[model samples]
Target: MKKIIIGTLSAMILFSGCSNFLKEDPTDFVAPVNYYKTEKEVFSALAGVYDILGNRAAYGRYLFFEMDMSDQCYMALSSTGQDIALYNYDIGDQKLVDTWSILYQGINRANMLLERIDQSDISETLRDNYKGEALFLRAYYYFLLTSNWGSVPLRLQSTKTPGEVDMKPAKLKDIYAQIIVDMTSAADLVGDVTAYKNAGRVSKSTVWGILARVNLKMAGAPLRDKSRYAEAKKWAEKVINLGYHTLNPDYTQVFKNHAQKVYDTKESIWEVEFSYMSGSQYEEGNVGSINGIGTSNKLVGYSYGAQKIMKPYYDSFGVGDLRRDWNINDYYYENEPATGRIVYAGNAAAIFYNRSASKWRREYEITPQKSVNTTTINFPLLRYADVLLMFAEADNMSPEGRSSQAEWCVNQVRQRGFGNLLPGAVPTANVDLPTGLDVVDFQEAIQKERSFELGFEGLRRHDLIRWGIFLQTMQGLKSYKASAAADYQYGFRTAENIKPRDTLFAVPRSEMVVNKLMEQNSGW
Candidate 1:
C-alpha cells in the first residue's frame, strides 16, 4: 500500500559515497550541530527517512510489485515468469546493498540528532518528542536492515569516513536486542501523537506499530525464537488499546485514493506523504516513471488493457473474497492532453491478460501527458488491520499463545476480504473449517492473509524471506513460465540467470571490496 507506481522514473537510486550533515552548510541550511532548536527542525530531519524506506530498492517500486508477481499481488513479470533473474531482482536481490546504504543514512541522521538534542534548548516535551522519534527511526531502519542482511554493523555514531565503521556484522541476537532497546525507550518518551498535518510521519502509535512488527519478525521463521512472540503481542496490544487507528470500512481506500485515507481516516497508523508541491515522495517517482514499464515488469498489468491483475493470483481468490474486486481494476480511459494522448496501455486483448492494481491508483486529477508525472495518491505504510494481524502473528507464535485470540485476529482480517464487514465481525474465519485448522494450517493461513491484506504495501519480500518461503516460491514461480523467449513468445529466461541461491542476493561487489567485514549472502 505504501508503493505508488506512477511510471518508470528509472531504477534503484544508489550512491557510492554517503552524505554529510556538517561537511558543508548551505547558506540557508540549519547547522547539524545547531539544527534541533525547534520542533520544526526535528520534523525537517525526518522528512526523508520514510523516503529512504520507499526507495525503489524497497517498496518504492520493484520489491513490492515483483514479489507480488511471485504470490498474492500479481504474476511475475514476463521476464520474471521466465527468469526470476536480475530484472526481477533489481529490488529484492540488490535490496541488501541499497538498503545497507539508505538505512545507514537514516540511522546516521537520527544518531546525529540524538547526540546533539540536549543542547538545542527545545522544551522538554519537544525534546523528548525528537529523541523518541530519532530512537524509533533508528530502530525502524535497523529492522529494515537486519530483516534482510541478518548480521550487520550496529553503528550508533554518524561516521564521516569508512575507517570509522570498521565494524563487522553483529549477531542477530544482539541486533534485536538493540531494536528492543530503542523501541522500548522510544515508547516511554513519545506521548500522544499530535501531528495530523502529515499522516506518514512518526507518532506514538507508529512507534508501537513498528515494535509489533519488529517483534513479529523476530518471533517468526528465520530467527524462530518463539519467546519473542509474547513481546510482539504486547506491542501490538498497546497499539490496539490506544484505539487510535481503525480498519478501513472500504478495502479500496487503502490503495486506490490512499491519500484520502492519510489525514482524514482512522485506518492509517503511518503513511509516507507525497505531494505535487512541497514534500517529495521519492519512491512514487522512481517506480511510476522508472524502468519497469517496457520490460516484463511493466506497470501495465497485462498486454490487455485490463488494469494489471495476474492470472494465477487472480484465480487464487476464494468464493466471496471482496479483496479481488477491491484489488483488480480495468484501465479504460485515455487522456488527451496538450502534452499528447495516452491510449490506455495494459488491456491489449489476449497478448497481456492482467488486471491493473488497485494500489497503483494514481491521480485522477493529473491530466496524463506523454511525460506524465503527477500523482496525488499517498502511500500507507501501517494500518489498523496490520496491527490486528501482527497481534495474531505474535500470539499464535507465542508459547502461551491463545488459539482463540489468534483466530479472532486472523478472522478480523480475512472477514473483510471475504466480504464480511464491520471489522472482526465475520463468522467465516471464526468458525472452524470442517477438519479444523491446526497450528501449521493457521500459520500458513496467517502468512497468506498477511499477503492478501497487505499486498503491494512493500512488506512482501521481507515476509517471504522471513517465512523461508521466498526461495521455494521463487523457484516455483520460475517453473510456470513457457521459457524466456518462445519464438518471441512469453515466458522465456536465459538459463544462466536463474538459480535458487540467486533468489537471495549477491553481496554488492563494492561493499565486499571495501569492507572485508561484510560477507555475502549464500548466492549472488
Candidate 2:
C-alpha cells in the first residue's frame, strides 16, 4: 500500500508540524498561495484532512473510548483509566480539549482544501469529487462536534493563528441544516461506491448513509423533530435501493477483513484508513490493542484489554445467535513463555467477570510483530448493515409500523447474522420477524437488533443517546452490575453521578479559557 504523507500548512494547527508558525515573530513555511496550485497538491491536502480521522485524539483513541461511557463496555482495571471518569459522566478537560482541537483541525484542513480546490487545473469531475469529499468530511466533523458538545463554533475558514479566531457556538438546528446541505450536495458530486478506488474515500452511497444517520438523530431525542423521520427513512431507503452494497454472509469476516486490510466494498461503505507504516505510532489504529482480549501472558500480542463487554450486554444474545460467539470471546489460551506452550484458560469465578470484545482481535492482525500496540486496521465508519438497521428504525418511527420494506431491510441483517443458515433452516425463534407488531414493539426490536449486530463498533452509545435511553439504560446497568457476583463491579456507577447535563460532554476548560466567545455546556 502506498503511504499517505500528511503535510503541513500555514494554519493554527493543533497537531504536529507548523512549529515555525507557532513561535512568535518567526517565519519558515510557504503561504497557501504557493501551495494548492496542482492536482497533486489538492490530493495531498485532502489526504491531510483524512489524516485526522486516524489521529489518536479522534477515532484512533478518544472517539472509540467514548463507547466506555455507554453500557456496552467498561474500562478494565488494567487499563489506563483515562476513560473511567467518562463512565460516571465525570469527564475531565484534557479529553474534551484534545477531541475538540483535533476535530476542528480536521475541519480546518477541509476548509483549507475547499478554499483552494477550485484554483487547481484539475478536470471538473475530479475537482467536484475532491470538493465533495471535503464537504462531506467538514460536515462529518461538525456532526461529531455538535453531537458531543451540543453547540460548537462552526469554523468554515482556515485560521492562521491560534487563539485569534473566536466564534460562538452555533445552534444544533443550524448545525444540522448545514450538515444536510453539505451532505446533500456531496451526494450529487461524488461517484458511486464502486467508482472510488478504495473504501477509505467517501462515495455517493457513503453520503446517503450518513445523511440517513444525521436525519435519524434529528428526528430523535434532543431534537425530537418528528418531521425529520420521513427524511431519515427516505435517505436510508435510497441507500438500500441503490443496490450497491450488501451484508457479508459471515459477520466475523467483516471485522477480520478489516484487521487484515482486505477491503470489502460491498459491506463497508466508508472506512478510515490506518497504516503502521505511517511512521507515527499514534497514526496507526489502536482499536485492536484497546479492545482485543487476552493478556501478554495469554496471547502473542500486547493488548491492554481496555474495553470489556459488560455482562448484561454479553448475555443479551439469544440461544442461537451466532453473533454472540463472534463478538464476545468466552475463553483464551495462556502461553507459557518458558516452555512455548499454550494452555486453555477460562475466567475464574470472581476475578475476571467480563468477556473481551473480540470483534477486532489482535490475533488476526497481519504483522508478525505481535507485541506492537498498533495495527494496520481500517476502521469501518459506515456499513451496509447499519444502513439497513437505520432504515428499519426510521421506517418504524413513521406512523406505519414495520412496513414491508422495513421488515425486509431488517430481516436481511438478521439473516446475515445467522451466518450459513439456509433461508428456511434458520431457527424460527432466531431470525424470524413476527407479523403485525405495533410501532413500539417494532422499534424495541430494532434497537435490540442494532445492539446485537453492531456491538463493540463504537456506535452503541450514540444509538442510546439518540433513542433517549442513555441515562435510563446506564442506571439499569449500574444496578445490574452492582448486584452481579464479581470481584469488581464493572461499569456500575452511583445514580447521583449521571444527570441530563451529561448528555453533552463539558466543553474543555482549556477551550473555554482560550475562546472567549465559547459557552460551556449546561451542568458541566
Candidate 3:
C-alpha cells in the first residue's frame, strides 16, 4: 500500500505514520529520511502481499476461469472479450503477452515487499513464515512464466535504481529447479493444513500442491522424463494425508457464489480470497449471484451471460455422470429495458447443438447491469479429487508401475459422476470400458478428467500442453472461427500457417528493449 516515500533514499531512519492501505504510486513526492519502525507497519505490508495474490489482474479472472478453450468447452464470443480469447488463443496469440505483463507485475510487487520485510526487524515466527510465503509467491509466478514463456529473467530483489533492473533471462530448466526449491522450502516452514483457510493462508498444502504440479510438469512431454513423477506423487500424497480436505458432496457445493465459506469440502484444498461488500467501497463480488439465473443484469458488469459448453465435450459425458447433471443449466433472463419487463433466454439451440456449459448459470436481476457487493475472484488451487488422481498418477509413474492404482484414481473421479465405477463397474450395459486397461491409457483418461473436472479454472491450458495435446485439442476451435464468426466475432487460420514461436510468448517488447541483459526466449 504505502511506498516507502523516501526522498533521500537512505535506510535505517525510524519514521512514524498511520497504517492505512496506501496507494503505491511510484511517481510520488519526496519524503524526509524517516522510516517505518513499528510492527503494525510490518503487518500492513504483509496484508499488501496477500492483497496482491487476491488482486483481479493477477488471479481474479485470468487465474480463476479464463483459459478453458480446448474442445471440451467454449465461450460465446463477439468482438470485445470472450470471442477473442477463444479464437486468438487457439493458435497461441498476443494474450500470452498480456499474461506475461500481469504475472511479472504481481511478482515485482511481492518481491518489493519481501525486500522491505527483510530490511525490517519483525517477530521471528511471523517474519520467517511471511518470508517463506513471499518466496513461494515469487516461485509461483515464475512457474506460471516458464510454463507459458519457456525462459524468463528471474528478478529477486526490488530494483530501487533504474540501472539495477538490467538482468538477463534464466533458462527454463533453471527456473523450474528454483521453483521446486522455493516450494519445497515453503512446505517445510508452513504449518499444518487444519482447514481450507489455514491452507488458504498459504500453508503446507499450497506449497505441496505447487510442488506436485512443478514436478508433474517436469516429468511430462516438452520436458519429457519420468524422474520427478514419483516425487510429484509423494508431494501430492503428503497434502492428501493431511485429512483436512475432501470433495463437496455434490459437485456444485464448492462453487456456490453467495454460499457460506465452508471449509469442509473434500475436493478443495486451496481457494483464493475474494470478499463481497456493497458498492465499490470494497472489493469482491458474489460471483454465484452475479452469475445467478435471477440476476438477469449484474452488479459489476454482465459477463455476457456465457457458460458456453462445446458439443463434443457435452457429448463426451457418460449418461450417468453426476457432474453432467449438476454442473450446467439452460436459462438466463434479460430485463426489457424500456418496459421494465423480464425475458428469459437460452443459446440459439441449433448452433450450440448440445447442452451448453451450465457452470455459470444462476438466478437474479438482469437487463440493466446491477451494482452491488460481489465476489468474482474465488479461485481454487487444489481439491481432494486431484489428490486421488495425483496419487494414481504417481503410482503409475513408480518403478514397476502399478496399473491398478492408476485405475483406482480414474475410477474415484468417475464414481462421483457415474456411481460405482469399480472393476466391472460400467455406467450401462452398452457403455463399454476397455478391459484390463494399462497405465498409459489410464494416464490419458485422468488427464481428460482433470481437464473437464477443473476446466476454466485457469489450469486447462497448462495441463493440455503437458499432455502434448494442446495443438491437437485446440485445433478444432480454429475451424470454429469460420462457423462462429458472427457469434464469437472472431475467426482463425489453419494450424499449418501458425508459427511455433507463438507457443512461447515474446518477452513483452518493453521488457526486452529496456533490459539489455535480457535476451528473448528462443523462437520468441
Candidate 4:
C-alpha cells in the first residue's frame, strides 16, 4: 500500500550546495506548462514531494541520529569525529547543509504540484485530496525548518527562476501561524483514515495528529503561546473521538510490524515509505541497519550500531516495564559458537557506552540477501500513542487542569507498555498512574513517560526544547556521566559538547552565501 515511485518526471529540483539558488534553463526541467494534464502525472509529482521524507539528510538517517539525540540517546562512542550529534558542528557542516537543502526540495516540489494540480483533469475529490496533502507537506517542511533553524525563508510559491533566492526570513511566530492555517485547511480536505488502505498517504487522522503536535510546540518554549494548548487539545480530541485508532496492545509488535513491512494502519497513522529495491534503484533506508543492534557480520544483519542508549534512560523505567528492554538492547547478535549461525548473545560487556537501540531489529527483515547499508523498515511520522500523550500534556496545561479523561489517556499508554492491555491479559501492578497527582506532578509524569514510550523515535530533543529545559537536561547528563566510573567516560562526549546555541541548528552556510536577505540565527 505504501508504493512510492519517482517516474520520468524530470522536474526534480537539484540543490546548489544545499541552497535553493539555481538558474533553470529550458533543458533543466519538464516545462510545467505542458505537464499536470493527467491525474497520474499529478500523483507522480506528489510522490516526489513525499520522496524527501526518506532522504539521507531527513528522516532516513540524520533526523534520528544527528538531530534527535539527547538525554535519551547519543552517537556511538565508536564514531571517530565530532559532528552535529555531539553539537560541535558549525554552519558549514554538510549534514546541516544537506538537511536544509533536501527539506527545501520537498517544499519546492509541493509548491510546484499545488500550483499545477488544478490544471489536471482529475476528479474533484482527488484534486482536493492532492491539494490537502501538498499544503500539509509544505507545512511539515516548514515545521522541520522552524524547529531546527528558528526562522527561515518562507517560500510558498514554486522557485520558477534564479531571482527567487533573495527572499528574507519570516518571523518564527508568523511561520508557525502559517503552519496552523495550512494544516487546518489540510485537515478539512483530506480523506478519513478508513478511506486509505495504508498509513503511507496523508489522511484526516494524520493531519489532526500532526496539527496537535504543531500546536503543542507553539504552546511550549520560545513562543510560549499558552492559547495554543487549547488548540492542541482540540485537535488531539478529534483523532481520539473519531474512534479510528487505538493503542496496538503489543508494544514490541508495533515496531516488529515496521521491520516486517506489515502496515498497521490503526496504530501507525502515517509513515515515510521505503522499499528494498524498486525498479533498477534501491529505494531503501538506514532505519534498522544504522540504529538497530550493531554488528558488522552480514549474517547477523549488518548495522553500524551507531546509536547508543544512555544508562540513565534505561534505568528510568520502573520494574516490569516491557518497553525498557525492547527499546534498548540488552543483548546483541554474534556468530554462534557451534553452528556459526548468527544468534543473540548476552551483552555482558555493555557499559553505558555500548548498548545499541533495539526497536527496529534487522533480524526480523524478511528480504533475502539483506543489504548491509539499508532495510525496508518504515519510519513512523505520527503514531496513535503520540496523539494520546499530546492530549494528556495539553489537557494538563489547560485551565481545567488534568481531567479524569486526561489521566485515562496517559494510563492507557502505560497499560500497553506494561502488557496489561493484551487480550485475556492478567492484571499488572504498577501499570497505572498513581491516584491524585497534582497538575505539576502529572506534567512531570507525562514527560518521563514520553521518554520511556517514545525514546529514540526522533522526538526527544524537541520535547526537551519545548519544555525549556534542554540545557539543564544535557548538563544533568554530563554531570551524571562525569561522576560515573571511568569506563563510562566515553559516553560523556555529547553531553560535554552541547551548548545553548545548539537548541537550533545554525543556518546552513550555503544558504548564507547566496541569500543576502537571510539573517543568521542569534549566536550562530
Per-model lDDT: 0.56, 0.73, 0.55, 0.81
| TM-score of structure candidate 3 | 0.78
lDDT of 3 by residue, 1-524 (tens): 11222242222111111012222222222222122234555554445455544544445444433443445554443344332244333323344445566567556655665666655666777677777776787788888788766777776665455455567788778788888887887776665566323225667777887788888889875787688898888888777677766555456655553134445434666666554333342445334432233333443233443435554555566776656544544433445332232332544534443234445333322222234334433556677777777777777778976656566665656665554443454444433335565777867777767765665566777787787777776675555444443633232322322344544445666666566787776554
Residue range 1-524, candidate 4, lDDT tens digits: 01112332474533111111112221335667888778766766777677788788887788887788899777864456578888887688888888898888788888888888998999999999989999999999999999988989888887766556777899999999999999999998988989876677889999999999999999998899999999999999999999879989999998988877788888999987766543311466788888988877677678888888787887799998999888987666655332233334643334545777879988787664678788777888889999999999999988976788899999999999999988898978877899899888999999999998898888999999999999999988875664445665667788888788888888888889888899988877
TM-score-wise, the better of 1 and 3 is 3
Give the TM-scores of the predictions, in the order they appear: 0.77, 0.89, 0.78, 0.92
The list of candidate 4 runs beyond 4 A from truth reads: 1-29, 77-80, 278-281, 336-350, 482-488
lDDT by residue (246-270, candidate 2, tens digit) is: 8887788899888787888889888
- lDDT per residue as tens, model 1, 9-39: 1111121111111111112433365565665
Give the C-alpha miss distance for residue 329 in model 3, angstroms.
3.0
Query: Which residue segments of model 3 deviate by more than 4 Å?
Result: 1-39, 64-68, 78-98, 116-122, 195-199, 257-260, 285-295, 298-302, 334-357, 360-377, 419-435, 477-499, 521-524
Q: Which 10 residues in a row give candidate 4 its minimum summed lDDT? A: 15-24
Q: Once model 4 is optimally superposed onto the true structure by TM-score, how far is the C-alpha of residue 358 displaced, in angstroms?
A: 1.1
Q: What shift in Å separates residue 201 of candidate 3 from its native position after superposition?
A: 1.2
Residue-level lDDT for 503 in candidate 4: 89
Worst 10-residue lDDT window for candidate 3 reads: 11-20
**Lowest summed-lDDT stretch of 10 residues in model 1?**
9-18
Candidate 2 residue runs with Cα over 4 Å from true position: 1-28, 77-92, 161-163, 278-282, 297-299, 336-352, 420-430, 494-496
